[model samples]
Target chain A: MTTTTAHMSTNAATLSTPSDREIRVERIFNAPRERVWKAMNDPALIAQWWGRGNKLVVEKHEPVRGGHWRYVEHANGEQHGFEGRYAEVTPPERVVRTFEWDGMPGHVILETATLEDLGDGRTKLVSVSLFMTTADRDGMLHSGMEGGMNESYRALDKVLASMK
Target chain B: MVHYSTSLDSSFAALADPVRRDVLVRLARRDASISDLAGAFEMTLTGMKKHVQVLEDAGLVTTEKVGRVRWCRLGPRRLEKENEWIAKYQSMLEARYDRLGEFLERTRGEHP
Candidate 1:
């Protein structure tokens, strides 16, 4: 991580409708829908990835409609906690949740994630984070989203394989 | 010194702001002069300097003088430190899964 040779791809203009605090990261996994869904639903499987390499403690995880989940990521002695309630849970298809974290008052996000089985045992995960306004979305994007998430997705690819 | 808060707190705090993160993002590609950075923002140059100072404090960027212009480049170390800290948390979960997998395998073998 200390290597510091970093470059960013500013594809902000490519987004269909750029929201102020929205963060979207799409990943195509070389696995079946069921397996992909398992990775997303199971906290054990999730702990392997999803956090971009942060050590996560699953305080609660009820991955069903109207269920709530809370977790903390510990790093460098500081703790980052996030909690949310699930709005929808259709296995191997889609899940919607309300996401809120520390420092940010109010959730400001009604997130919906769609899992599409693109045939051939491949699944595409699209996460849409809807924030209060474009400024909040832009704020998140600008605030280390590119670097943090890029590193996380890379780690997720490896975790999926190790688990399978 | 933050004896054990993890090295990423400062970096994360610095990046909590969009303006500071923008400064770091710009430095991700190449170093830019103060004016060049100020040109990219809607705020005044003084406002931009305040933003850059946050990045500087977190060790994500470094500014230097080359004649009348000040040059800034991506510090890179702060990110590496932050990544290392975040990766530790992920590693913890992965290890737990390993134990669970082993337990499941043992149970399957014993039953079947």
Candidate 2:
């Protein structure tokens, strides 16, 4: 009785329609919600998988509202640090936090990760990252690279036109 | 990084205003004099100049003095790299989730 709409995703995670100031990513993990939560909250497990392919070490992880979290990754002989503040932390359900990449300095994004039980042993995770502005979000999309901003600028024009 | 981000902040802040965005849109289509921008926006010369000043500060637009008029045009590389940084991290996040799934499976096998 899986009501999950068929997403045209070839990978485990599906990054859906991204808006001007937000990105929506969803993934279904073949584990219970509690297990999934523990895997994310536990610094030991987080260090193992948080880096994608880089070496990540968790310097601090405080899993409570108003708690602070920091982690550093070493890659190519350079250390990159990331830190955030937890806005809300509800076990096995939802967590809201602000994420900032120290590499970029002032760019910060507020993210919310929500978990839903789909019966049996499957859990669905949806995470949304909200940027401060459309340009910020667009900048992330263009991060570390170069591309024309005409499309995004047009989109920004539409957004601004609608707001007026 | 501080200087880079501050410029981006200025760019975003400049684009946040509807009038400023419209002025950008107009300039993107063609180079315009400050007077032309002011005329299109139905704003005063000083008002439009302020918007242009913000855009110039962000490096989103550039202006040059042509005789008694100032001609403004779009910046050379507009937000091209901004999307790359975000896109890179997005793939990183996706990879992390994939690894997490694998880790969870291995843990299950180990305990079960």
Candidate 3:
């Protein structure tokens, strides 16, 4: 494994309808649906990539209906925590959960992820987040979380490119 | 932390309805009065006024009262913040998905 880089680039195409009730993000991965689902559900694998290269530690990951999960990310000597509960979970296909950033308690979002099998060992992932109010949905959009993630991706891309 | 201005929420809510969105598109191209909007949409004057009120509350439209006539125009830079906010998230999601792809590629042999 290459050392994680200090900067990251972003190329994610996230979209939120003007409805203010939901935000949908879609992407295609060069892996089978089952593999993509497993990578998302498995705590061990999640820890490796969930934090955008930050030192992520999974405390619990129960990818089953009514189950709960928690993970912490250590960045620059500070630990950030996130936790959520599963609303629905169907292996290799779909999972719905409630996500909340511990730093901003009470601001919870219902997130649903669906994996679609594309022939040739590929899969398309669609994740949608629903908020209680337009304000909450807009809040997440304006949080600048996306900007930070883009930076992390750029840095990670550089590190991976160097390995090749 | 997630934080959005109250006006942002109002703006989105105002834009949610098809009629309101059309109103915005019209205003974007040119200014019009409440009666003009009503006539264009085939809506009642009262109905148009309500819609205009919603847009004005959201700062999406500016209304000026000239004598007894109120002229309406698109609010300056009204959609800028919302569009920027959406664009950032769209790109961010793309990057995250790319990482998912990388992780899958690296762990394929191990998993399967």
Candidate 4:
């Protein structure tokens, strides 16, 4: 039985688990596919947004097949490093890569990001991450929560208060 | 982060086994006696007990003795914690995507 649940809802993004070992994040951006693709691939532009307003240092970014990329985001006096290797890089369409966090070594996630043109200058970016095992996927999910728990606690408090 | 890492490591270790994961999934549907679980998984009672023990240690499952049977169910913390983790993951990505949208707006006219 598939117990897929919508954990949270936002105006522009949706996250879902399509399978036991997969995570799919889909977002609609008010921009053309090419623009969205460039922002995702260009190191300078990636640094501006990938960190979620945190100080992002793009150590190495080569958005090409077989290229390596590393980015470090500084938040709350902590440095979080992420590195990956591009497996496929078809511009304005799809990019596949392996994402690994520095904190947890050897638990790499294979991510495939596809940009779809929705017309009228809109683009849909779908990113699916496939993990080696269900446990690895669960571990990654928990780590994400633990890492951002402090920063998001106030927002969660507001949510809880509104619910009550 | 260290504490989180340690706890997550144990959780991952506990869930690494397929049988244990299946046990959690089965328990999520309804509480079952240890014998019931062993029968469903077609494993020996002692083997199933070992898997349940690992899940219990990770706080993913809870077991109790009622008369002659040891009943197992999803732990008190399991579903809530899983939902919270998923929500946190979604919100984190949403925040980043919002920033990405802003960045796209700023560089709308730039050539790729």
Candidate 5:
């Protein structure tokens, strides 16, 4: 009932849980809606940003409805694979897709992203991910605490420590 | 199945009240007696006790009577875990978005 908003930093994305089974992330990008949409759907452009500067290989990408997409990110000598199928796609407006990580194959998240034009060459992206159940949502969130891609930072820390 | 949902429902119900949520936040900083909490929040002892009771029922707070004063503190079930997870998730997204923002800046004229 109480929405928990986590603001990472100034001028960054904000994440919240609006319902028991949903996680919402809202962010503003300094670009037109069309350009943002193109970057999101284009495989090369997605690789440029989706991996947080890590090398990302877009093995397959099809933004059309019912199309399948897969991406592999290489970080800290580990590969993280993510794949999904597009349920709906409306260019420069909205997209609905199913996202499943290879580490946790059976647990899939239905994600909906909407782009709103801010009219000043900026766009607001609202992404809401719906889990099958509250437990699934909690599990996915907690799983990030351990073996998720975020662990690469810890691995990097170890590597840096050895160098010193 | 029923037990899990019931406990989760109660936790949500307990957190629904702003006062109760504030109590948890204050307790997270340090434990305090019931009277201390009531005085800090500017509420009557009876009213603060009721809020603490709700939190206790939800397993979010625990109270113990030390002599005459009843001390309250966070229970075994801490909401900090959930908050930490959300914060980490937000940071990960923010990092990727930062890169996305940079890409947009570099390719602005090309895209237009």
Candidate 6:
């Protein structure tokens, strides 16, 4: 049997003292929610900005509950492959998915994205990933992801520019 | 070579908490008796015992009995196991990025 334990969570309420480990990132995109939503969904747009500047080949993608997603991140002749099932997917608003990298054991990362429309063309995307433990959270934070994420955003900016 | 994961599910389950993390952090500096460790926590001694048991189970700390004197010291292997697991993923990411750079270089040459 699989074991899953949840903390009191650093979300809306601080009810219990269940020790929590959390990571939250917020970004505002100049495009409208509908347009931003499309970029998140369209494979063409995703390919352009996914996984830093590496080539992302979405071999299979089905964004619905119980759907499976498998993609390969290829760069410099090496590949970082990851795949998982979608637990929940709400278009233009939310997506909950399980991520696992085949190369490493215990590399499971559950991710959640919440998008809010600011009534203007601008939209905000907040991503929170709940890792297995504090060590796991720190591993990602210290893994030099800051550069990759910034690069991904620059690519996204290019995508928005093309749409304009 | 120091990677060892003793299959004490309960012990690891207990170590998976922040309160317990605080206790382990304190214990690492020096060995202490039960009462001394419990005194540092807001929880009761009885409650602290449960946490101590978890640490013992995870093999992160050991409690010794010398004429009813229960002393605990940090068990270094448990920390090693966690770090080893993290290191594996890092190597994987680095390898992947190395390949991406080569691919980009080839594309530039061909287009030029």
Among all candidates shown, the one with the greatest lDDT = 5
Model 1 misses residue A40 by how many Å?
1.0
Reference contacts preserved by each model: 0.00, 0.41, 0.39, 0.53, 0.49, 0.00
Residue A72 miss distance in model 4 (angstroms)? 0.4
Candidate 3 is graded, for docking, as incorrect
Q: Is candidate 1 or 5 superior in DockQ?
A: 5
Number of the candidate with higher lDDT, 2 or 4: 2
Q: How much does each candidate deviate at the interface, measured as C-alpha RMSD after superposition?
A: 12.7, 13.2, 13.0, 11.4, 9.6, 15.3
| TM-score, first chain, each model | 0.68, 0.73, 0.72, 0.73, 0.74, 0.67
Task: Give the CAPRI class of candidate 2.
Answer: incorrect
* Positional deviation of residue B2's Cα in model 4 after best superposition, in angstroms: 30
Candidate with top TM-score is: 2
Q: Which of candidates 2 and 4 is the stronger one according to DockQ?
A: 4
Q: Rank the candidate models, highest TM-score first.
A: 2, 5, 4, 3, 1, 6
Candidate 1 per-residue C-alpha lDDT over A1-164 given as tens digits, one digit per residue, 9 for 90 to 100:
11111111211111222432454545455556676677667887666554545677888999888899988877778888878899998887999998776645463467787888998866666766665544565679999997899999999999999998
For model 3, how does the per-residue alpha-carbon lDDT over A35-103 read when each residue is reduced to its tens digit? 788788888888877776778899988777888999898988999888889999888799999877765
lDDT (tens digit, per residue) of candidate 6 on A84-141: 8899999889989877776654667677777799998666767665556555667777
Lowest-sum lDDT 10-residue window in model 3 chain A: A1-10
Which has the higher TM-score value, candidate number 2 or candidate number 6? 2
**Per-residue lDDT over A1-164 for candidate 4, one digit per residue giving the tens place of the 0 to 100 score:** 11112322333466566865677888877788888888888887888889888899999888888999999999989999989999998887999998877865676678899999998888999988776545765687788866677769978999999999
Query: Candidate 6 clashing pairs?
Result: A75-B99, A75-B100, A76-B99, A76-B100, A76-B101, A77-B99, A78-B99
RMSD of each: 19.7, 18.9, 20.1, 19.0, 15.1, 21.9
- Estimate every model's Cα lDDT from 0 to 1: 0.61, 0.75, 0.72, 0.74, 0.77, 0.61
Error of 1 at B23 (Å): 5.9
| Model 4 misplaced regions, further than 4 Å | A1-11, A135-164, B1-91, B106-112
Model 4 chain B weakest 10-residue run by lDDT: B81-90
Which run of 10 residues does model 6 chain B get worst, by summed lDDT?
B93-102
Model 1 lDDT vs. the true structure? 0.61
Tens digit per residue, CA lDDT, model 4, B1-112: 1233355556766654545666676676699999998888677899889989887777777889999999998875484544333333344455677778778867777755
Candidate 6 per-residue C-alpha lDDT over B5-79 given as tens digits, one digit per residue, 9 for 90 to 100: 554455556544545665665665578887777776655778778888877766777788888777878765455
Enumerate residue pairs that collide in model 4: none
